[model samples]
Target: MDPSRTLVLNTIIKEKAVFTLFQPIYDLAKRQILGFEALSRGMSGSLLESPDKLFAIASKQERLSELEIICREAAIKQFVSLNLPGKLFLNVSPKALLDPSHPKGETRHLTEVYGLDPKRVVIEVTEQDKVDDANLLLTTITHYRELGFQIAIDDLGAGYSGLRKWSELCPDYVKVDRYFIDHCDQSVVKREFLKSIIELAKATSTQVIAEGIERMEELKLIEQLGIVNAQGFLLAKPTRKPPTELALLKSLHSEVRSSVNQFEQSMAIGWLAKEANAIHECTQCIDAHRLFEQDRKLTSLAVVNDAREPVGLLHRDQLTEVFAAPYGHALFDKKSVIKLMDKQPLVVDEQQELDTVSKQITDHEFDIRRHIIITRDGRYLGLAPLRDILKHITEEKIRHAQHANPLTMLPGNVAINEAIEQRLRSHHDFSLAYIDLNHFKQFNDLYGYASGDSVIKLLAEVTVDVCAQSSSFVGHIGGDDFMVVFDNNDAEVLCHEIITQFELKSKAFFTPEHVSAGGYWATNREGQKQFVPLLTLSIGLVRPDLQHCINSHQVAALATDAKKEAKRYRNSYLFVCNRRKPTVSTVRLENAG
Candidate 1:
């Protein structure tokens, strides 16, 4: 290090010439600003103007312990001044903690100066170098934790000896570096590494945060991987004064939550019936008989424990036959119903997926328990008979098949409507692209019906392939029209790719003579012969602003309008409606391959 630079660093530390800025960290699941990380900054145009340079110069001069203490004091005072609602993430060095005058009990005392609790402070230890004394560091961390402070290990994968630090210290939170998060969606190795880290963190009872999420795609992928907390510039930038109200935090959280829910629902089973229609285990046989006689539909009753957990099931027919026998009522008129209950009954969890649960029930041929008890978390929720489960499963299969397009076998209007409602109900921003092939009728007329079916099938194949990699839902809306519900913000880019693929494959649909001619001659609707151009696509895009549109119908109406406008032009086009307003942007896709 230079002598002059060392002098400047010492002068700054001695005078406490530094201030702190805060960057917000968001909670993806709760959809709120969880806390702000304190960042240190020096006076502009000085040797230590930026955090990187400041820390670098201090570490070189062997005065980093002094510099960190000064910076922390200023940060704490300012944070108290602002009266921030969430936890404060304060950076600390293991060497600084071991300083003779570091004041082990001062953290609790300092926070109490402005009516602050030490519990709200999270001491984030950054592992720049290996700790010389791991036992001392662990003891110091435990001391702070006992005073109601939290511990976090920053830049886990980017630093040296981070795994050892994590294993020994066992911080409450582990922050994954941006190296793993940057373009995570595109890299299989990064995704797998992050998933394993998350699993390890879960096993250790530690929460993981994906740091440095600057792109929408990165944020979407990280959230999909189930990391519930994150800090990044895409969500919010660091500011001198952190925001008290989390307006942007709420918005991005809704987007992440909606996308995750929609993706999970694509493979979800239909809602199952819970524990309803249950009878107490202590009811007498005569009283149970009277209740059954009152309602003919009550063919069976589930006997539950004091905690409302299912114990057994009682078949009405068997019990009634016993009472109907001569001198049978006198023999067991006052006996408890528990004596007659079926001790071993079919008990299934309510959350079991439709297919798996159905298979379990039908696996045994001789067992004829009339009703299957549905439970939630080991507690009786309701009763579902074999009849109800079979009916529901059958209806779901029939619904799927009936709503599928005959030619492409993709979801049709019925399934499309349900998917739209599901997305809208999640209350997140998403795009619904209404895709239609232009002059499809002309192609069908020029070629044969079989040729037309091939084109439809081709469109379906491309749409499915594009959507298969994403959390998007694709449906064939009959004829040459289709629908796509996008989970990511790359709707336009995906559309362009789809159009390019379709155009490349368009030549194969035409004969060489017709291909050279560009198109075929066809009679117009006015009964006049005119030359029509080759097949093109018209896509109407509508992304409902959840703040304005309350239902899927409103979004569909806007998209339909955009579709009409897109179809006006002869070339392939993408039209997007801004919102409830009529303003739209039309992208022409002429000469696109």
Candidate 2:
């Protein structure tokens, strides 16, 4: 290190010139801010402005412990002054934490002085240097936990002993490195890595926070992978004073509500939500206890903030356990319910789908007896009993099974019609593609009924696979016909991919000689010997006019007409009936080989 830089560092540390910026970490399911990760930096426009440089210089100067303490103090002081509503995640380097000269109980003392609850502070153990003493680290972490501070492993996958440290620490949160989250939507390997981490987190009862998610696709994939908490520039950037309310979060909630609106009432979790009273987070434990005592049927109560947003959950049993203890009433009755409530209770949006919510509950390993908190736009709505949700999901599954095609297990005509009608009822602009196999009867005649069934199943798989990336609904229309209802505008692109994939996969069903010939001799429907083209898919897409389309029947008729138009092509084809307006009937055709 330069002597001049060392002098500057000494002055910086002596004056405690470090400052902190907070980036909000969001709970995607609850659509609320869970906490803020405190990022410390040096004086702006200085050589040590970057945290990396500041920390590297500190380490080189052998004053890492002192510098870390200074940074922590700055973060905690600002966090309290700003009156941030969520947990404050302070970065604690393992090296500093393990330093022999590092002052013990300093963090607890800081929180006490600032009148901040130690429980609201999460010591994020950063992976900057290798840890040589595992037992010492565990003991130090235990000391923090005893002081009511939560533990989190930062940059989890970027460290030398990430898994080892995680096992040893069993931290409350593990922040997955940005490398695994970057472009995770496009990388199967990264997705698998995230899946493994999520599964491990679930098994261990540890929450995983995906860090550095800068893209919308990354955020979507993280949510799809069942990660509830996330931190990244995509959500919010680090600032001196972070906004409590996020417009992006509200927009995301609106999108979720809109998606759920597309489904029928029976399919959404909102219908299962029962009216339940909520207690303010500031309500005393004694008052909450009395409320529970009055209602024998009430098992739990949602704890909400002044804005009616759910902050936690208070269980009757938990309160009962506390009061049942010796002098428990004297010890805790006057304390706020927030002190006794489950801060990480399973809270879900009311607009979430039943199946999606079910998966979330199961993935989180939530007990069925502990009711889930339901919210609409982050505001308290009601409680949904897990038993009722399971029962509804089971019933829906059975109903769906009955309405599913026996051949491919895809949704059958009843479900298909319902889907179309539901879309039309909601006035959602969607495209319905009627798909048919060209020369299927002749191919079946030559290959036999078993081969014909196989071909139909193949088409179902292809269509479903191609549309899997989107919110499209693929249904089996029976025999050689299939249907895909595209909720997104990429129907044409998906159609082309389906045609290409089916053509490639279907070649396995034909003999090499017949495949090379590209045609087979079969008796025609008129009982005349004729050459029939190899099996090919004919897709007819029709965008139903929201204003003109009255029902699924009309949409089906239009799709069928378009399919007839597509059959005019001798090869695999997609024929689109562009219903841009009620008065216009434009046709577009594309052949796929």
Clashing pairs counted in every model: 5, 0
Q: lDDT per residue, candidate 2, 457-561, as tens digits?
A: 999988888887676788887788888999889999999999999999999999999999998888877889898888898899989888886767777877877
Reference-based TM-score of each model: 0.60, 0.74
Task: Return the lDDT, model 1, position 282.
Answer: 88
Give per-residue CA lDDT, model 1, range 438-461, as digits (tens): 988889988889999999999999
lDDT of each: 0.76, 0.86
Candidate 2 clash pair list: none
Best by lDDT: 2
lDDT score, candidate 1, position 162: 86
Candidate 1 lDDT score relative to the true structure: 0.76
lDDT (C-alpha) at residue 325 in model 2: 95
